[model samples]
Target: MGTALGTRSASAVIGVEQSLPSDVVVDISGALTNLVADVFALYLKTKNFHWHMSGPHFRDYHLLLDEQADQVFAMVDAVAERCRKIGGQTIRSVGEVARRQRLKDSDVQELSPGAMLSELRADNVRLREFMLHAHALCERHEDVASASALENWIDEAEKRIWFLFECSRN
Candidate 1:
């Protein structure tokens, strides 16, 4: 990501280098929007879990939720940085998050511990799906590096979501 360091060659895809194609630029815009949706989902779910969770595992769950919130906040930067790198506009509002998010929303106040896990797992699944779709989009545009990154993220999301969902079942 260093501007002065190892630069990948610009392809037909936009923003990879100077004179990026218009369609690629637009595609980057859409990707950024969806990524912000991801950020919103991550933040909301973390807060929900941190507040609502209860059980014999309460302390563990609480700490994990806090950790997740921090990690997710950090990722918000990565996603936003990707948008900036691609010369696309980043999402600026909860309204924009709602508009662009593929993830489902839930009412935080209404949620119980079990419900929090359920909704968070659902969002992670949604994110996994989005990453897969993004990977396919990159494939069509012949953007192998971007496709690879998306595929990696999709796998990680699926694995984490599965763990959270299974914990809820027990």
Candidate 2:
């Protein structure tokens, strides 16, 4: 079957000279591509909240989300390139990202600081869950490099969740 990028198989493109089977590469790359999508979704939502922030804690909350957004955006390239490194194609368009992203977009006209942080915390929790599953998939396939990357990403997601949780507390 064709993959999301409309490619028949991951190894059909230029070979990356890996020992892993084509199916294994395809599975790991698919999981990583999904991570890239969720990362993009979360990054945009963080920026959206950052731009629309208001209230007494505006400065603190705004800066927090801005920093988080930057961190989240930094993961995209590495994840996408990881797919290529494993002989697979990553996301090619925003449409693919949107289609694969599991995070819900927040488009409410306005959101208070607490609501913003809480929503973000929930999303980050979900992101961490996704990463853990990807890590497990890597382990199952003996993809140590991808698993290592996922471990760091999982830690980053946990930190984001903790920060958002603490910030939202009264």
Candidate 3:
């Protein structure tokens, strides 16, 4: 098969190149890769909170973090796959994720339950912002499938933010 871009895979007898413009693919893939890194970082942070939760509300908080972490993790594969579908590469290692992630790392050895919730809520909000930008890029490129996927991700991130906000409220 011939790629829409007329580029042939070096190792494949028959392979198709991406149909999207190179610049659009680069932009979308870069955005998605950054989103993947942020999602992975957030997943680890949520899991850390889930494991270290301590307080009268420990059980509830732990369960919430676990659920939220699972949701964040679920986005990783989809984002990477989307990059691949566009004939772009994604983060291949933890170091790459670290380099690309925009979310700041939590350096405190201990964080209060409220602090954990607040931090996660903020990060989710940031992730939603990135998703919105990526969605716009997809729209500009007429990539409806990727745009639809981003819409779903944006909904998920918004729900997480709402839940975290509610949980943090006194």
Candidate 4:
């Protein structure tokens, strides 16, 4: 299979002018898995925050969380599609995502607006690091499509981070 970005997985052997090597697929797959897992992790945090948020910013956060969820979910889909392109299988279960994802699991109960915002901001910043690494890997392979997707992901994530900290900036 192949990601929508036009990268496929097999085995990585970077030599010729035609066809990606099978071993190269393995290398790219490893990198893509990291990307996919990162998106899945961030996805859970946003959705969890959406469901369990409380306090003064409740309505505002609710709407923001929805937007965050949509963004992360779209990224997750792209990541999984990358897996397919690289001849790897996507991690399909929430349970798997929970186990595989590196983001923290917070108890959403009784969290204040400030608390939730802090958590989201931290998570997004961490995710941006992962995106940077993934983007670098994509570039290493000359996978322009994957790199471009990563750029978009970083831009969206940066906006969410700005939104989370908007109040504090004042």
TM-score (all chains, Cα) for each model? 0.78, 0.90, 0.88, 0.81
Scored by lDDT, model 4 comes in at: 0.74
Q: Each candidate's lDDT (Cα)?
A: 0.68, 0.88, 0.86, 0.74
**Model 2 lDDT, residue 169, Cα:** 87
Q: Each model's RMSD to truth, in Å?
A: 4.7, 5.9, 4.3, 4.9
Best-to-worst lDDT order:
2, 3, 4, 1
Root-mean-square deviation of Cα positions for candidate 1 versus the true structure, in angstroms: 4.7
Cα lDDT for residue 66, model 4?
A: 85
- Return the clash pairs for model 2, or none: none
The TM-score, computed over Cα atoms with residue i paired to residue i, of candidate 2 is 0.90
Q: Which candidate leads in lDDT?
A: 2
Q: What's the TM for model 1?
A: 0.78
lDDT of 2 by residue, 20-139 (tens): 668887898999999999999999999999999999999999999999999999999999998988888899999999999999999899778899899999999999999999999988
Winning candidate number (TM-score): 2
> Model 1, range 9-54, lDDT digits (tens) per residue?
4443436443334576578557856876876777886776787778
For candidate 4, write residues 1-170 as lDDT tens digits: 35443655555443222235566566766777766777777777788878887776688888998888898888877777765665656676767766667778776467766777788899899888888887887787676666787899899989989998994353
The 10 consecutive residues of candidate 1 with the worst lDDT sum are 1-10
Which regions of candidate 1 are displaced past 4 Å? 1-19, 108-110
The CA root-mean-square deviation of candidate 3, after full C-alpha superposition on the true structure, stands at: 4.3
